[model samples]
Target: MRIEISVESPQGVRAAAAAGTARVELCAGLSDGGLTPSVGLIEAAAELIEVHVLVRPRPGDFAYARDELDVIVRDIETARKHGATGVVVGALTTEGEVHDACAAFVEAAGDLATTFHRAIDVSADSRRALDRLAELGFTRVLTSGRRRSALAGAPLIRELAGRTAVDVMACGGVRAANAAEVAEVTGVRDLHAAPRRPVGSALTGDVSYAGVGVPAGSDHFETDPVEVEALCGIFRH
Candidate 1:
């Protein structure tokens, strides 16, 4: 089993490598489900662990405008220049089908391994979408089987795993508590997890950003090395 740790900070990158993770999906702003990480973050993480930079331009839907598509492509190029070994990217049509824009993103990635991101979860039909992604030359697809969690979507993951088109990575809501069982049921060798915990931030005093309240001393999400180690231990067993 190969453990892929989802990391958003420099600390997480070091911890993931130290904890025996095989790779790290480098991203930023996990609260918004993840956006593209900075070139600096990609370069730093790439040096410590195999980095697969997330190519998402923003939060919300996967259907992107032409300008947004351009940004994603540029980010892919920046990641490559910074020493990233692969990239995680995807796009969906307004009709919820895998978009042709994905092909452009993959091409921009050049020889880097490209894995279709979780946008597959929102596709009109996952099976058909998976087929389309395979046709696009993606080596892997990260999905939660159209559900909020991989454990909840294991049946479809198992079915997709049976197909030879591409490798299915079980993602979303994965943790030490159920990582082993999820792998057992889905028959997936690749597992993606964030393994994070809330920690107090330096910000003080009541602050609200666009009506959302931030407490005097806010809290931020940070990856827990112990959690990563625990999850990796399950796969090793």
Candidate 2:
């Protein structure tokens, strides 16, 4: 089984490489699900390991405006220029179907591998959407079976793995504890994990980055190397 780890920082990418992950989904703001990482981050990550840059322009719904899509395309090109092995992207229509504009997204990828992100989970019909992605020439689709976690959605994930020609990469809420069950139940060839370890913020005084009445804290999460190593052990054994 191929183990892909999502890393938001260059440090995370290095940890994934040391842990022997098959690939890294390079992005920023894991708190926002994921957004396109900077070109420098992509370049640095690609040097450490095979990197698949996320091309999301924003955090909200996947239904993108023309300007937002233009940004996504530009980010895709940037990722390619940085030697990304693949690009992760998705678009949806207002009615929650796969967007027709995905053609441009795929084209922007040129010869690089393209993996449709979990925007399919919010689609009207995930099975039908998977078929649509396959027709669009997607090399893979990352989904958690339209559920909160892969273990909870294993049945549907398994079905999609059997039904789709595109690779079904099980993702979302995957951790070391449930990795084996998810792999066995879904029969997937790839698994994606982003296990985090919370670290304290060094800012001590009245410094607050959170504006607009939001509570202020510098505490943040980063990929945990121990978690990555433990998860990788499942495939090794």
Candidate 3:
């Protein structure tokens, strides 16, 4: 089994490396479900660990316009240029099918490994979408079996794991507490998560830069290395 951690900052990347994760899914704005990280961040992360850059231009739905697709392609190129080992991406059609524009992303990625992001969860049919993504030559697909968390979707995840030629990386709300059960039930070897804890800022005041859902005084979140090690320990036995 391999553990993959989602990380937004250099410290998070270092924590993943220190904990010996298989790779780190490098991104920015993880609170918004992860947008593309800066080129500098990508470069810095690549130096410490195997970095798989998430090529999302913005948050929200996976359906993208031509210009947005173009930007995503460029971002893939940027990830490769900066020493990324892989790229995580996905695009869906307005009709809730896999978008044809995804081919451009793979082409731009060149020799890098590719993972279809959780966009498959919102597709018209998760099984059909996985098949199409496999045909498109996606190396893997990150999914929670169309559910909010992998544990909640174990049955569908197990079914999808059996049905696909492409690797099924179980993600979404995965944690040390449920990691072993998720792996056992879903029969998946790869688990992905951003194990984070809030760290208060030194600049304390009534003022706030926190977004919605974030508490007024919270500074930011940091990936917990202890949590990463605990999750990794589950598979060691």
Q: What TM-score do all the candidates reach, one by one?
A: 0.93, 0.93, 0.95
lDDT of 1 by residue, 1-237 (tens): 999999999999999999889899999988788999988899889889999999999999999999999899999999999999999999898999999988888889899999999888888998999899888899889989989999999999999988766899999789999998999999998999998876665556664423113344446778999999999888675
Over 4 Å off, model 1: 202-218
Candidate 3 residues 1-237, lDDT tens each?
989999999999998998889999999998899999999999999999999999999999999989999999999998999999999999999999999998888899999999999999999999999999888889889999888999998899999898968999999789999998899999998999889987766675665655435555667788988898888878776
Candidate 3, poorest ten consecutive residues by summed lDDT: 207-216
What Cα-based lDDT does every candidate model obtain?
Answer: 0.89, 0.89, 0.91
**Against the correct fold, how does model 3 do in TM-score?**
0.95
Worst 10 residues of 1 by lDDT: 207-216
Measured by lDDT, the strongest candidate is 3
Query: What lDDT tens digits, residue by residue, belong to model 2 across residues 199-219?
Result: 655777765464222234536
Alpha-carbon runs more than 4 Å astray in model 3:
204-212
Best by TM-score: 3
Write out the backbone clash pairs for model 2: none
